[model samples]
Target: IRVTVTAIPIPMACSPAFEGKSIRKEEMYAEFGGGRSPAFELLRVRPEAEVEDGKVTVIGPEIETIPEGSAAPLGIVIEVAGKTMKKEYEPVLERRIHNFVNYGEGSWHVAQRDLIWVRLSKEAVKNGVRVEHIGKLLASKFRIDFPDLLDAVQVTLITDPEQVLTAKKEAEAIYDERDARIKGMKDDDADTFYSCTLCQTFAPDHVCVITPERPGLCGAISWLDGKIAYEISPAGANQPVQKGGLISAENGEFEGVNRFVRKASHGAIERCQLYNFMEYPMTACGCFEVIALVLPEVNGIMVVNREYKGETPSGMSFSTLAGTIGGGVQTPGFAGISKSYILSDRFLQAEGGIDRLVWMPSVLKEELASRLKERLKAQGKGDLFEKIADERNAETIEALTEFLAGVDHPALTMDSIL
Candidate 1:
């Protein structure tokens, strides 16, 4: 139940008890990212010459100088050096920043990669927890959590508006490179899948089933990344799960996967359907990314990404849904997923694939347009693209049904959802 029980020199206590805690807008001293400003974090393997153990560098004004309750840009770059460190481990280690930051009694972090949203509490600021303390906290935990793989870990925190903007672009390139390393792979094409239990720091029984089509719900570790992580540290969180007999091809249940889930969840969970959201869906750790839930009013489903601050047809904001869905529990009618999973051929396979997709935020809709267009064309449902709605079209259950009917949306005519 304890994560990094070692002493960390910070104003507030550091423990797993605070891992998924939230800080409200009124309770926040300062906020960053979350669509308000550019923010990103990256971890890189560096030569010993480039790393200074325990160094925490804060660029721009410290957190104390920032105006209360204002959002700011942020960029965190961690340079690590060790005899065993490899580039393949960058994402695996970088994601720990989310865990370490949330460990702060007064700090809250969500999502991962460029879509991060972080908040420092008024109480923490009053207790002298500054921006530099965040770097110190991360530096200590990185070494503590991966002692065998990291010898030295130094951190750089950039908060200047323009600098953060520039640094985010640089970090994005690195993300693209990592994503490219495992392109054009398929789940069934291989004999085995991968697992990620790193988030077990907070959601102990949750195990991320990483396949080529479905990345971790946090949107950080892909199937290829999981494989590389296991190779780097065979005893680590990522492990290979051989694809045994198919229990249900429609719902994406494998004999080997069910066995692994039972063992990993300590017998707490016995069934997990990877491709179905309304029946035994995988447990959600609720770190970041997107959430899909059925809106039975119109016989369809809607997806809301972390950046979407407004309420969805499901009558909940992204944060509210995250709180309700996580804690290693399987909610049959909902699932936490990466943005890329929406484009996968297996998305909601048992409930009728992407055809059940009725609404999403416009920004996300546009973000996946080209690739989604190709997917729709391949599925012979290219016209369904225009039929899909967004917030501008409808934000409530009644409005969504009206809009779907007005547009003759396929979901309205499809099979029952519930």
Candidate 2:
């Protein structure tokens, strides 16, 4: 059978505004995977003989047939084959799906991996957009973006509950394996690290040196992601950073990192301590997943994520704290970090590690529950996890201090964070 390509009309005249625009709940025609149902997007490298180029298949009802305002289970599986396609680049390519999909007019995508949440505006659906169009859009963009790395691309968009369930299981396994591989990997294991200048668009001098133990502050790019990005585009935002002589292992200072930061920041920052917050902390680019700040009064640190709206133990909200340290300035006693990095073995090793953590949003704590427990246990502080205060436990520094004292929090006895 032969297939025909048709251009689907996008709303808002297909302007760039649609690229990163968010579709609020009321504006959404349909939504998927914001804890509503099983949803995932996966990409795999397949042998040339196994891939059917340009194939776009929708396993269930098309978008046009679905009722407006309905939520459905969705799964996207993309397979590509090329002479140069490597398995290591699968995650990198998979991540592009979010950007490509969001570029479609009236389409909004947020997050990534299994926790992806997407919405199609009523305007797009009314303009004859179908689920298969998503596959087509993705295939077209992938081929254009990675002409040298991808020879054939195929997309399978599934909406059937059984199909989504089966696909989600497989996707979860892949995600787990990727996470495990990254977890087992260490910064010391590599002779080279990577620098991500993507955030430079906002903070021109900010450079993110991504390592295995510490991913990008945005919680989006991993060490592997950075490596793949550099391979794909040598002059792109992600570039290789040779790990030169170690400067101070205790503070995670490297000759190469310091030199690179100085050059990248145009001498704005002369030094940076990767594993410490109080001494020459890395600059924030405003996209960090979490921010940890010293609470001098309590001699501890309070952690807050981008999602937290209430005041933290630092007497500041997330937005307030973000503005203070962001924009490529190295603020002592303040550091931006990824949620996953909070569980890494190298988490703030210089400042007493996780033991320095005194407060975090309850939601953030709950999200990292499993890994937090394991990390704490490895540090022989398994019982300390329960002692950490959240917004519900204490919204003010005074209340937070009292709660920490009551729980016999370890941070109380640690070195003064100030």
Candidate 3:
């Protein structure tokens, strides 16, 4: 749905025009998340009796109380009640939080789920903006955008350190639950893949190709979510792409996908590989939760998430590299991805799959540790998990090489990444 600027009781203007706007460090008043402190955002479908329309509550510190230019903890919990809203619809709606929050001209938001990092400009606080206003904006927009599906929307913004930490765990558990819904389904299981253009406003020529194993780059829409979204609104941005004929089974190129991506990108992109990360892989929009790139110096690859602010062994920060590869362009040797996509059986298949991975953030490694172990064990590569390096192990390519050699990581002996 198109974002419309409406009369909301917030000091800053809200519109799609600000969705891509950046608030540099000098312009900030307060910042949250981005690994600064615990932070999360969650949306849930609640019973009709549990939600109160237009209710917005700030559980802790208000704008006036937060110290200037300091990092803070935050948790946004939204509860919605509607006859048509189902548990399956939560993720798609939850993702709208990123877009709507970015709508505020003085506020900048990046990433999603618990990895969200937000900034508020001093200019906005001077105009009387407060934390509660954010909740008001969300409650107002959710109703305005999904009038047919939502009868009531209530938002609770938690800034209290204790509550933020508590709510974050609740949100993470739900996120894990949502991610498991499409497990065991493979790309070969379906003849028809799905495409979503919901991010066209951010990247005009982008088309999100969603298969059973790979989700949208935003990490929000799954293959089942795509089918459900299409069923809900046939005329909506999500549509099905028939996998007409196989172009390259190993590289995950399909004749019908090529045709659809060509038309969807308005001829900007002709071919998209569902699994290849080193050559003409899927195009990237702005909101990918993670990014994977080839580390030619080491003949391996490194994965970086949005929450990681430090430089990787490849000599670039996540944000810096994202700027180079994003905007719906197909960048060979690099690909944007969702965190869950790392566990997929098809991840980087063209580059020798998981064996090519060498470095990631320590936090990300811990987050994926449990499930990653299971996947590695299934592949009889459980020993490979300990071979991977994080920032804690090495922050530079030279250091990474030494670390890899010491650990005897498999990527050191893999085929040439190029």
The lDDT for every candidate, in the order shown, is 0.88, 0.81, 0.89
Instruction: At residue 178, give the lDDT of candidate 3.
Output: 86
Per lDDT, the best of the predicted structures is 3
lDDT tens digits by residue: candidate 2, 1-418: 1323234332323323345456877888898775577788999999999889889999987776677898888898999999999888887788778767876777776556666777888877777777877788888778877999999999999998899999898988887677676778888899888988765644768988899999888676789889888988898878888778898898899999988888888888898888887978889977677898888877788789866677887878987988799887888999888778888888868988777788999989998899899878887888989998998989999999899999998888887766
In model 3, residue pairs whose N, Cα or C atoms come closer than 3 Å (at least 3 residues apart or on different chains), thus clashing, are none
In angstroms, the error of model 1 at 118 is 2.2
Instruction: List the candidate numbers ranked by TM-score, top first.
Output: 3, 1, 2
Per-residue alpha-carbon lDDT of candidate 1 for residues 1-418, written as tens digits (9 for 90 to 100): 4555558988888987788678988899999898898899999999999999999998898986898988888888999999978888899888889889988988888789999888999999999999898899999999888898899999999999989888888898898788767667888897789988888877889988889988888889999888888887799889998879999889999999989888988888898888887888899987748999988888999999988899898999888998899988888898999988888888989998888899999989998899899989988988988889999999988899899999898787788988
Instruction: Give the distance in Å from residue 263's predicted Cα in candidate 1 to where it truly belongs.
Output: 1.9
lDDT of 3 by residue, 1-418 (tens): 4656678988889998878778888999999887887888899999999999999999989988999988899998999999999999898788789889988988878778888888899999899888888899999999988899999999999999999998898888888888888999989989999999977767888888999999998888899989888877788878999998999988999999999999999999989888886667888887899999988988998999988898888889988999998888888988888999999998988889899989989989998999999999999999999999999889999999999999999998887887
Worst 10 residues of 1 by lDDT: 1-10
Q: Clashes in each model (backbone N, CA, C under 3 Å)?
A: 0, 0, 0
